[model samples]
Target chain A: MALKFLVVDDSVTMRRIVMNSLKQIGHENFVEAADGRDALIKLNSDDSINFIITDWNMPDVSGLELVKQVRANPKTANLPVLMVTTRGMKEDIIEALNAKVNNYIVKPFTPQVLREKIEQIISTVNV
Target chain B: MELTNSMEKLFEKLGDLKSFFIYGQKLIPTLQKILNFMQDTVPLLESVNKSIAESTSKIPKATNQLHSVSNATELATTEILDLVDGISNELNSIFSKTSELKNRLQKQKELAEKLKSKYQNDNEIDEFLSYSLFDDELCFVDASSNKIQESIMNITIALQVQDITAQQLASVNHLINSIQEKLSGLLLDLNGKERESDKSSSQHESITFNENARYVKDNQSQKLADSLVAQTNGVKSQKEIDQLFSNKNE
Candidate 1:
């Protein structure tokens, strides 16, 4: 089965960028969510969403909170999450790691970097 | 009897002072964290600016790459096609304006350099002063050099927003620091001495403050300035900041 991704970001441009990047990598099946709350709703509604790529800073329900919520829920606990964010500080990375994000990529990353991170996570993790 | 009453009142005041110090001590770390976060925003803003500037500068290059890639393979989705088109359309105007500004600045720098070399020697300048057009030439060259200098200075000032913001953060850090220091001083006055643990905790905060100060000081405030001067055509990206830190660690 082809992997389905949930691309969550507040910026429509960034979401489109991620979507375009995914398309370049031959992964066309994905759902878009504007924020973490919307992402939770989509994740709940769609059982096919095997992976998540989210931005850290959002108006409501941040990416870290989303990761924590995902881990707390049994249905989505094992979902692979990759954090793509502008928060590049060491402390920020540590916080994301502590929140149990599968991988982290700081912006503005190349599409190739995004592809590799996704592959790295997908290959290592069951999701 | 009078002395005993005065001593009791003094003890009560001391107790209040100690309580105030304890509360102030509790707030130090959180304040430190906020200041650090604010300090971090400078680089974040600079990164945003760099990305915007670079994207604008790379429109043609990116458009060409898209053309090459699309020619090689069929696009997998409409989203990809839209994204490429969007990037091309949005950045096209910006790219043209940036290119025009870059060319003008380059020309200005070259003219300034040429003027400087022409009139740099004082003896030659003196001999030329006897000529009727010397004043005209002098005024023109001086104006050109001043214009070039003004442009360079403006670029430097623009990049210095990071430093300015960092300084503001540092000021807030210092204000909180002074408050903490005063609180500690009051506690010491009340107790007539410091407890070992309280002393250690205060020392820890002092170390953290020093660390924050050093972090600010170590920042390459001149990185943008230097790069702008060196690569008049190619502005450095966020990667330069990343590379700077990595190199520092090495």
Candidate 2:
């Protein structure tokens, strides 16, 4: 079974690159959002999206806010989230963990790291 | 008695005028000094106001140039990505075609083996074997395909630098705009203009960005971030455990 992904980032370039990486890792089903605000709207509308990969520091509602919203809602609380971002600071990563991101990825990541993170999340969620 | 009262009234009036004259004498020099100070300070104030205006005027242009750089990089990145995607697609086509041919070649070799076993006396079957799809040829195609795919992924990874650098630039832009706003306020104060009440003040919030965003060539930060996350998950890293024991022993 193919897992659907919601790939969220403000950059069009990052969005395409993430989707391209996902495709390389053999997961083709994707929904793209330009920011966290759009990601929430898409989540509310789409039921099949099981995985979310988001970038922090977006324009309006950020990825952290979106993750918090996901955790607050009983419907999507258990869904897996992987934060792919350039914010690699210790405090930033800790803040994200407190926000309940399942795993974190710093950007400029190789395809292998990406695949490993995604698979790690899927496996952990499965367990 | 009436004459004495009139005399006292005249003296009183004269004394009041003498005091008034003395007060005027004292005030005249002070007033002149104030005028002199104003004459001396006017040009200095004017120069400051002019300096502020000049500085503030150039800021918008600097910001606009930064904006231009961001836009130019974004455009270039998009074009490069388009080409990279094309190349990736070509690699995909090559990979699929090679895999399909390999499968077909395997079927041919299997059929050839069956015929050889059926015809034991046919030694010519060995000579008739198809050497077209050699192992080395397929291996070369697979290896090259892997190498090209890796290169495409690396290009994609490198393009992430654009986004990182753009964020850093944005942080700078935000700072410059803030400085510009502060200077504009200072200019208004210096010019003695009433700050036009900003009707839209703080009513709508604009985007806030990470001020400390920066680009690093290598993502060594990830390893540290991962350890932090692991710790938060109640998983102790080996280094942390060792440090804890060493501290306890000490």
Candidate 3:
């Protein structure tokens, strides 16, 4: 199944790798943003985006803040967010989960792991 | 009685004068002692005044020297502060420049990596294409036939096959050469296209390798070309053997 996925990361390399991996896994429809602010702008304009994969620390409006905003908005309240970041602190994980992130994948992950995590999140959200 | 009273007054006057003489006699020693004391104390007071004047005169000179020293100290301190500030500014500038250089270096590293990956991907595509087209098993029989024809062309007429058979062989060779040339040209075109695509974009553009494959599949003349070349090689080898036997009999 092809889902419209939004990939938010400050690193261009990381964005390309993620997009390529997703494409390899058979997800063709994807949008990219450099930071949470850009992601918010994209989301506001495109309501059809159902899945979001974002990095944690960014220059403007971090992933956690984006998640909170997404959860708060009635239009995007039920949107599924998967945080893929290098922040492995327990407190950060708890905070992200509290902010309504549906899933989390750590950095330095293989394409297979990313595919698995995306599948798990899609399944859990039933999107 | 008046004369006696006057006489008493005179006597009192005389008595007072006598008492005055007695006091003067006693004061003479004390006056001499006072003169000696003045003689001894006058030079001491003069020396003290002179010394006091000398000290008072030197005080201003000492104070001037102290002021000059203080001024020099203040100037030195100010200069030192200025020097320190200049050094600090230079250090700050250097640090900022170093930071900028570091950023540039990081960006360069990323670019080099991207270029390296692209080169590797290009090489992989080249290898795949080369393997598909030029592998030992996949080489067209026409290429070998062309090599054989070139060899025949190099040989002397003494070894040349009969003219009729040679004509037949040459015609087959021409067909084989045409097929091989077309295939090589197609492979070269594919390589050129791949190189252009690599140069134009970092992003993966849609490539239609399958389309080319389909074209290759639809080309029925290639099969006929292959068969003709194979037949020609077989006939040429038989002719060569027959010539060798005829030469031996002669």
Per lDDT, the best of the predicted structures is 2
Candidate that would win on TM-score:
2
| Chain A accuracy of model 2 expressed as TM-score | 0.97
Please tell me which model should have the higher lDDT, number 1 or number 3.
1
Per-candidate Cα lDDT values, in order, are 0.60, 0.82, 0.57
After TM-score superposition, the amount by which residue B87's alpha carbon in candidate 3 deviates from its true location, in angstroms, is 52
Give lDDT tens digits, candidate 2, residues A1-127.
5799999998889899999999988889999999988999999999999999999989788999999999899989888899999888776877787677888998778778889888877777851
Better of 1 and 3 by DockQ: 3
lDDT of 2 at A113: 84
Candidate 2 stretches greater than 4 Å from native: B1-45, B111-133, B197-208, B234-250
Chain A TM-score across all models, in listed order = 0.98, 0.97, 0.95
- CAPRI classification of candidate 1: incorrect
* Interface RMSD in angstroms for candidate 2: 5.4
Per-residue lDDT of B1-250 in model 3, one digit per residue for the tens? Answer: 9999999999999999899899889999999999999998888866765655455445444434434453454455445434544554555465566556556656665665566577866675555444433334323443554454334222311111121122233334334334434444444453453312222111111110111111111224333322322332323233553443343333
Output the better candidate (1/2) by DockQ: 2
Badly placed stretches (over 4 Å) of model 1 are B1-83, B86-250
Chain B TM-score for candidate 3:
0.38
DockQ of each: 0.02, 0.50, 0.04
lDDT of 2 by residue, B1-250 (tens): 9999999999999999999999999999999999999998999889989999899888877877776797799889999999999999999899899989989888888887888899977877676665644778899989989998888888998898888878877777777777777877899999889766432322212434566656665668889777765654533344553443343333
Model 1 RMSD, rounded to 1 decimal: 26.1
Interface RMSD of each: 15.4, 5.4, 36.4
